[model samples]
Target: MARDGLAAHYQGEDIAERILSALRAAQGADARVTAEVLAPLDHFHGRGLAATTEMAARLDPQADDRILDIGSGIGGPARWLAERFGCHVTGLDLMPSFCRAAEALNAAVGLSARVRILQGSALDLPFPAASFDHAYSQNVLMNIADKARFFTEAFRVLKPGGLFAVSCVGAGPGGEPFYPVPWASTPAESFLATPEETRRLVLDAGFDLVRFEDRTEAMLPARRRMLEEVERDGLPALGWHVFMGAERSLELVANTVRSDLAGRLTTLELLARRPG
Candidate 1:
């Protein structure tokens, strides 16, 4: 998909306002805005905040570290990291709406000083070489067609020995995934690579692999439960559906689980380091 087309896929009007309204409704109108309070609603990927928590553990950020959050939707993980680790986080994404929402939410949670939001592409990071101590991306690779450039740019921006933790949905052996998944509405917007290709791209980018896991089997049970819950009671009040639209979001999430169960989708978690 073209850059504009890709941006359009995730675009929404009054995104920040809508999310804030939902938050206030879920909690009390005067409830204090904090990262933990926003946890259930802000993380826009599969498994939500739990996935971000796991990725942070792998990155092992220090209080003084400068971290990059590639494809940070609404700055959930970035704010969470900044609050928990006292690290500085720069969140980059392709959608202008998302960047605006991220910045607004950062201020809402009193994390504007610690978290910065930028609207940009993963394939072309707007930074100097060796700029950050570590980097991470979650569920963002499926939209990027040039996987090589994505990995290469990440490698370029990280300081030597900096860790990069990435978790994404890869192509499974069982044909193609069902359409209308969370990341894409159709195959035109989705660009999934096999596990072998993903590993090769990371290695080719000069990153020494620290850990790589095919988490498909390990995560299937949880995914099934999520699907069942959605089917049983519909989406919760405070969730990604607030911005993505409840009905469309339901279709997207259901197809994701269907694809996974049918072996058309696979999840991967990778930890790599720029060699010293």
Candidate 2:
């Protein structure tokens, strides 16, 4: 029963309220994003962002480089990259509201001059060839059905010798199916590719796979710790209000653990070169 629609309910005040309430509940009274404008849920996302930044830094782009963030959500990762690496960032996402909020948050953080978001899909980015020095994404590939097209677009925007680093949830060796993210009924409309399949797709799309790491093992222990912490404190008491009211959140976590234990879902990172 995976829901195939674009989780687009996250528009306008109603969706904003739900997100804010969830943030307030999980973050206690002092979340970073203001209650008026829903910001990217950073507590749950920062660790991954940090990991991506570390990986991208290893690429060693020049200080004045421009980077693209595919499927950037609320611009947290983009801002993180800008602040940490002194790079100008442009974020693209299919959600207009997300783009607006991302811009607003960038302005609020006084990063508007360096970080920005545009309403665009990964399938068709509005950019000229060789526009970016580096491109990176996190947790986005699982939702994109067309891996070939996704990599094609990523390759299209990047300059020669540019680096592309991505982290995503993918099917394990068995090639399992999808379920909705926690608290939502049904599964995601998209399919998660196997690690080998993903690597082949990237290579096919003309990227030189510099490094590919299957971190499914690392994610297992991390999720177990998160579950233990959440169980000790109630959902509201825990710092995960972002997914609040989605009773299925716990279910999703359980399923993720099950999949990881069974080697079905993996957290993998891929580093590729656009070929100078």
Candidate 3:
């Protein structure tokens, strides 16, 4: 496969070599995390069946739906959702490399009929108002510094009564800021909020809060599982291949995991509805 331009830009020459090296490491990292079926290194398909299953159920997509995925990194979750739910998807990400790679993957998987990848930011989507039946983002918010603008944009693009669902890393105890996500290097401008603050932002954005909950417990185990895999196999098993090839990336991931464990970062799921 020719290197996707955006990936080549970020990953540089020898994307395949780098990816394969990471995958090999992940394969040995953890029997549980790496077990051929659940690896995060395969793409960015982190956490595995449970996360995807939960997402699919929460999305409840339909053939009539036109869904938008914000901050889609190479369209992993978007691809999974389209195939599983049979809905059309428009994947938005700032990185051209990710968009190109995602498009290629969609074509390879014969999902081009249902998926489109676009390059853009969540704060300024190219679509018109109320254009989509639903919108979703996963692990994407922490990289952004503007929750108000983010939620407002999500609101702007969703049709009346449409749903907005998100899974993201949030603040730890006392609502401390969690920072330095893959998209950013500092939490100084990275915005995070508690469950309550999140709700406020959504309501202010003109959406009705449907449900919100801390899902950290379910995912926190993944960190332990990740490190365990590393200890036992020397790398992770699935979906996080990019993190394994370079020592710097590995250190970044390790620090990230450490942050998660220290309760400096937490994760959650939130659902809101555009009122009719």
Candidate 4:
């Protein structure tokens, strides 16, 4: 049911081809393709690539690590990590279109050898036990109704000493968030857990929590700056709006920021290690 909701929310056709056309237009048809050029279009969460940068710092990936990207959309961060750290990345997305698009983008960036894309559910990750050295997901948990299963699957796929990092939107202290947020339209499609419940689920999943922070305060300045940038420059020619729809994308971003400020929504950054 949750998967169906997410698929419905993110469903699109020919996402890869459209993004390729965007890239070609932006950088010229024959120009070199890189994750740097694609970041704006493929970074589909709050604060865009900046959030990925901070997550990467926390992840501290090594050159040869086998990293799993949960809910990797079009392989942006997967390619980025593979490019920046020379690591092998396998990305899983619930939407087949996203997985297909990820493959096409990986091919475009010449990271096909390092980044693999698969279509699967986070609740039941298709990989075998101890399949990954490290793993992470960004802004992908809110759509999920089963937080415990998500963490358990993450734990199962990771090596004993593997670490799983995540950045998620948590339910805030106030009442419900506004409708038409990024993850869902009405309350039926969204499943936001409070910070306390989020932590407890991770612990129950057998991961020793290394760090957990409500990054709402930290994200405020960046969030505001982004709104200003949008007001000043409007939407960029190249962005995820191609898939998410321009007006809807803009509204969702602005609404997310508004909810954050209103204490209706908060972001959480977490790091947990499967006990060695």
Candidate 5:
């Protein structure tokens, strides 16, 4: 799919307003809007806030650091990291709607001073070389066909000795994943690399691999439960479905879980550092 097509796939109308309204309905009209409160709704990837939390732990960002959130969807992790670590975070994504919503949410939570949102592509980041202290991307690689350029751009932007953490779905031994998954509606938009290929690309991009894990086996049980819950009771009121639409979101989640169970998909996590 072309860049415009991919952006169109993820775009939503009045995203920030809808998200805020949902939160109000769930937690009273006057409840405070904190990152924790918005966790269930804004983190637009697999496993939601839990995945972001794990990536943060691996990055181990410091209070004074300047972090870059590649493919930041609605700034959930960016706001969370800025609030929790007292760090400045710049979130970049391709979808204009996501960027606008992220900015609005940042202002809503009083993190506008700490979190910044930009609209851009992962293959071509909009920053200068050695611009950030650390960076991370969650579930962003599947949409990017040029994996090498994605990793290379990330490597180029980080300061020497900076960390780059990534969590994404990789191709498993059983072949292609089921269609209409969260990242893409069809195979044309999804470009998954195997675990071995992903490792090589990171290394070839000049990152010293600190940790790499194929977490599929360990995460399958929880994934199954999530699918079951969605099947039985439908999507929760405060979930990704708020923006993705209930029926489409349900189909996406179901396909993702079914693909995983069939060994056609694998979850991957990597922590790498730039050699000084």
Candidate 6:
């Protein structure tokens, strides 16, 4: 499987422990490990917490909704949704460590009962057809070369009228993004699609588009502020770097910013609904 090797790339001993240590360092050991405290670090995307917050609003999940989070990462967005909307969330990721970390964090936030973490691939979702009321993914499509399968599985998993919202970095017109970006270390491992192609694939998978927006301009302001902070203050004492390892993460982060600025990548926010 193209995604099987990713588990090693993301794996680190004591992932849950490392995250807890970082949280303690940043917010004091006595502080509660609430979703609010984990928000910044949990969101592993371009705009971080801000992006997740916006995506959640677009989803507008109902209290009894069954939400599916594809490539859920460390379950940050899923946990947030479950807590915020009183929804039941199932989070699936390729990395076992990520699943473990997600479960631990969910437990920490008292969401263990609401959120279920599964280790799996987006191309072949393990859930039954028409199982979920809503599905979403963030920055996960870039790694999936079989765009059709990815979209098809999401579509199949959704109940009629279910919504699938996503935010992703698409292939750009100018050139190619620098290697070791957040999703992949090399070009072969990344399978970015143009925004138009992404839309076509989703439609081909039988979804009706509700909205699609080029969100780069909105994301740029937040990204710029982050870059400025990095230049002035350097990295913070407590963050994902603890797990990603400071040395490699710095370069990957810089490359992502450079690639985004060079027009080699574009950010998009899209919403699609399963036709009843």
Better TM-score candidate (2, 4): 4
Worst 10 residues of 3 by lDDT: 30-39
Which ranges of candidate 5 are over 4 A from the true structure? none
Across 27-123, the per-residue lDDT of candidate 3 in tens digits comes to 5544232112322433353454566567768779998489999987766677777776778899998766566666765765677878888888898
The segments of candidate 1 whose C-alpha lies over 4 angstroms from its true place after superposition are none
The model with the greater lDDT, 4 or 5, is 5
Q: Against the unseen true structure, what C-alpha lDDT does each candidate score?
A: 0.91, 0.69, 0.68, 0.88, 0.91, 0.85
> Over all chains combined, what TM-score does candidate 4 have?
0.94
Candidate 2 C-alpha lDDT tens digits along 1-276: 332255532323333345556666766767665312232353223244457557666666566689998988667677766776678999998767667767776775678888878888898889998999999877778767788999999999999999999887777775563354431234445567878899999999999999999888777777777667656753443323343334555555556666666776777887999999
Model 3 stretches with alpha carbons more than 4 Å out: 1-49, 174-183, 217-222, 243-246
Looking at candidate 5, the ten consecutive residues that score lowest on lDDT are 1-10
lDDT of 1: 0.91
Clashes of 3: 19
What tens-digit string does per-residue lDDT give for candidate 1 at 1-276? 366667767878888788889988888899778887888888998889888998898898999799999999888899999999999999999888899989998988889999999998898899999999999999999998999999999999999999999999999999899988999877888999988899999999999999999999988999899899999999988888899889999999999999999999999999999998
- Model 2, which residues run further than 4 Å from truth? 1-4, 8-40, 43-46, 173-178, 182-185, 235-240, 243-248
TM-scores of the candidates in the order shown: 0.98, 0.81, 0.79, 0.94, 0.98, 0.95
Query: In candidate 6, what are the lDDT values of residues 121-198, reduced to their tens digit?
Result: 898899889999999999999888899999999999999999999889999886889888878877767888888999
> Which segments of candidate 6 are over 4 A away from where they belong?
1-5
lDDT of 4 by residue, 54-122 (tens): 889988999989999998977899999999999999999888888988998898889999999988888
Residue 100's lDDT in candidate 4: 89
Candidate 1, pairs of clashing residues: none
Model 1: which ten-residue window has the lowest total lDDT? 1-10
Scored against the true structure, residue 98 in model 2 reaches a CA lDDT of 67
Error of 2 at 208 (Å): 0.8
